[model samples]
Target: MMKNNVSAFVKAVSLAVCAALILSASAVFRAQAEKTLDQMQSELDSINAALSQKQDDYDSLNAQIGEQKSRLGALNSQISNMDAQLDSLNAKIRILNGQLLELNKQIEKLESEINVLNDRIQQALDQIAEKERQIEATKQLLLERLRATYIAGNSTELEVLLSSNDLSSFLTRSELLQRVAENDDRLIRQLEKEQKELSELTRALAADKAELVAKKEKVEQERTSVIVKQSELQTSADAVHKKQNEIEAKRNEVNKILATLDTNSEEYRRQIAFYESQREKADSAIEAYIRAHATTTVPSTNEDGGTAPQTGDGMAWPVPYNNCYISSYFGYRDLYNTGNYRLHKGIDICVSGGSNGKKIVAADGGTVMIAGYHSSYGNYVTIDHGNGLVTLYAHASVLTVSAGDHVEKGQKIAEIGSTGDSTGPHLHFGVYDNASGQFVNPLNYVSMP
Candidate 1:
């Protein structure tokens, strides 16, 4: 009996020691789990903060875009007004040109008339000179004849009457002499009248010529004034045309700016879609992991005899669909056959053979952290799954979630696609530890689909 009691006591001691060890392990595991939960909560808070900041940035960008659009609209209105003003100015210039042309024609006609009048005046002067010369010659011939008659003893009218041959003959001779004297006086009066008329005509013609010259000069002066005015108007018109061209150039610049803004807006929308899809996929994965690893109660205590909490502790599949296969695994390697080395931070899955609109599910429950495109990832999405863990989905066809939105596990977030630097239809999945701010292998936390 003593031997049996001793043996039983030894067995009891061993059982106690084993129980103690188990309790100790249980305590350690509980502590670790608590630590993990705290870390997860903290990460969730950080994700919320980041999402808020991103939302603010997005709002500010949207407001700026609106303001820019308004400015562009105003510029368009100004351009329209400028166009109308330019058209009016152009019409005025055309009318001015027509008037100038007509004025030139009138001036030409006036000049032609002035030249004709000058020729007529010159001809009149030549005729008057010829008449004066003929009159002078006739007067000289008459004077010579009168002198010869006086020297040859030809008496005056009374002397001729006294020298008559007889009473009857002398009376007849006296009558003849009286008749000749009367004819001479009449000839002298006629020559004097002709000379006076010729002189008056010459003076009239000279006055007419002077008047015509003055008129021509006046018309020429008017033409010069018109030409100067037209030139001034032409200069003003040219200035207006230049201003119109400047306005047109400004309008074109405005149009280009607007086009750039439009392109940026489109890119932003695409980025938003990509992020939404990623968030959805991450939520779905987390739900799947939770359902698969669910427990009825906390597990037994460890070596320390402490209880452990029930929790999900399994890898998650990034995508909901099972039709795809991984083409590349995450690791450090050279890409594109380039000498430069880089880390392959994500797994590339080929989904080309999958059904159309195959869903991409989330890897965990968390808030959407990033819902846009990165330069390298293209159409990408990022979700913070808490505990410093963030899952990324890239190259999605469509996204259904948004930044800052709370997502549950196993939610459908996107459709698989080949967007942005993808060789084929596939999902590039990655996980990043927020605490380390470095990429980790997605395979460590997510099951392959």
Candidate 2:
């Protein structure tokens, strides 16, 4: 009996020792997992920071573009005003030209009239010269008549009368002398009046010609001014047009910059995709290692594990929040549709606007087959319920269990997050037949409510 007791004590001690060793190993394993999680978190932070910076840059570019567009608008308005001014100037030029044309015709007419006036003045001057000569001749003739009368004297008149030897002959001689004197006086008066009238006409003609010439000079000066003003307006219009071209060129430059930014954005997306691809490979290796070693502690126990589950066709919703909507559906989708006809095998559910901090629960009671990070399904958890049932919950921010841990239906497993290759906070729930190791539609096994 004592030996039996001793043996039993020894067996208990051995079991305790084994338990202690397993606990120590589990602690070390957990510490390694925590280290890995920390590394992933640091990388995630860096990636997030880069994405944020990129977004800020894009926004700044958009703002700059907006400002440039506003400047363009102002420039366009200025250009429109300039165009209107140019049109107005052109109209003014046309009107001025027309006025100038009429002025030129008027000036030509004035010049013609001045030429006729000049000819009239020349004719008047010749008439004045002839009249002056006639006046001088008549004056000389009058002077000679007067002198001859004086020379004959009063006694000569009486002697001539006596010499006539008859009263009738004397009377005829006197009448002839009086008639000659009257003719000379009338000729002298006519020459003096003609000379004065001709002189007046010549003076008037010169004055009229001077006035016309002055008018022509004024018209020519006005035309010169108009030409200069037209040239100035044309130069102004040209400057405005040139400025508009410059603005357009600047707009093109801004557009080019925007295009380059677009290319840079695409590059950032590609870089993220490349890193995710590398992470996916690493995650697969880690999951494989976990699965190979963990299977001993956690059994895949259904004798008919090869068969597909029919009872758990409709299970509980994985997200424990109200107002949640399905972001994506499964079955032959573009999600993960890499060349090999990969259809979406999961359903993504999220709340409107956001789903962060929401709890993720299991659909049914099961042993946690895997609980760790995947590159595509970050901070994920998988459960193996009996009878060939397995469910995966992906894209979690916080994990609450580890491999080989038992969980219950509707129990919280993680927090919804925007991890892995996700655009926002959401849950990706999937189901599979462990027997066939094939994916199944999550919607078929999960009730929406």
Candidate 3:
């Protein structure tokens, strides 16, 4: 009997030692898991920050593009105005060209008139010279006759008769002397009149030539002015065209820059997708680790040292409110009425009176693995029941528990409220099977209250 007792005592010590080793190892594993979770959370936060920065850059690029487009619009408007101005300038050029052509014609006509006047003046001068020669000859003849008369010294018809050989001879001499004097006098007067008329004609022709020359000079001056104006207009038009080309080149450059920005934006989107995928992977890892090492010691007794109430499958309903109904069911559905389908992953519960401020309890006795705010789940609590079973109560307004807190089944852990991705006040109750590594229907474990 003494040997048997000693054997039993030795066995008890061995069992106790084994348990202590197991608990120590578990504690070590738990510490490692927490460190890993921290690292993963840090990585996720870094990814999120990077995503936010990329989004800001994308927005800035878009704004720049918008500003560039606005500038392009202004440029186009300026181009349009320039085109209209060019058209007007060209029209003026056409009109000026026509006027120049007409002026050239007038100048040609005036030059021709001046040439004709010059020819007339030359002819008049020739006529005047011929008349002068005739006048000189006649004057010489008259002077000689006058000298003969003077030599005769007061001779009359009686003297002429006295000098004649006979009466008939005397009469003939008298008639010839009279005719000579009259012919000489008439020729001198005719020559003098012809010279005077030629002189007048030459002077008139010269005046006409001067007038034509002045008209031609005026026409030339007008043509020069028109040419200068046309040249200036052409220069202005050329400048406008140059500006248009420059603006077009700038526009092309901007378009190329926009294309590059688009490409960069696409690359940013790809990076965001990769990071989001990494975040999902990290979330899976966190869920796995939490499930694996969530509970070390599960107390058999409740806080009051009494047995907790449980349903048929070892889980109690999370909501104790009467007349509560399932607003949404688990599985795939078009929750947003969009064509895309998404997994519900949980059941949403609401009471008849109102689900606001409703109490949310733990489904079973376990340790709280997570009790905090989530972007999608709001104020939520995750409980780890032993044997790889876990429950999540999400979209709560108030949290009554914290992480690592031991909770009993039917113990209030949170209050129902419309937080996060919710349409109204309700409790999103989800059940995860860590053994299967997937979420299961909560209805499979807990019955409706």
TM, every model: 0.45, 0.56, 0.54
For each of the candidates, give the backbone clash count.
30, 1, 0
Candidate 3: tens digits of C-alpha lDDT, residues 33-136: 77786686666666656655665676677778788788778878887888898899899999999999999999999989998998899999988998998898
Preferred candidate (TM-score higher): 1 or 2: 2
Clash number for model 3? Answer: 0
lDDT of 2 by residue, 372-438 (tens): 7765677899887765667888889999988888988889999999887688899989876544445
TM-score of 2: 0.56
lDDT of each: 0.63, 0.72, 0.80
Candidate with top TM-score is: 2
**Segments of candidate 2 deviating more than 4 angstroms:** 1-221, 238-313, 320-322, 326-348, 352-354, 363-367, 374-378, 383-394, 406-409, 419-424, 428-449
Rate residue 27 of model 3 by lDDT: 98
Candidate number achieving the greatest lDDT relative to the actual structure: 3
415: Cα error in model 2, Å: 2.6
Q: For model 1, how does the per-residue alpha-carbon lDDT over 20-71 read when each residue is reduced to its tens digit?
A: 9999999998677545544544444344344444444555566676776677
Total residue pair clashes for candidate 1? 30
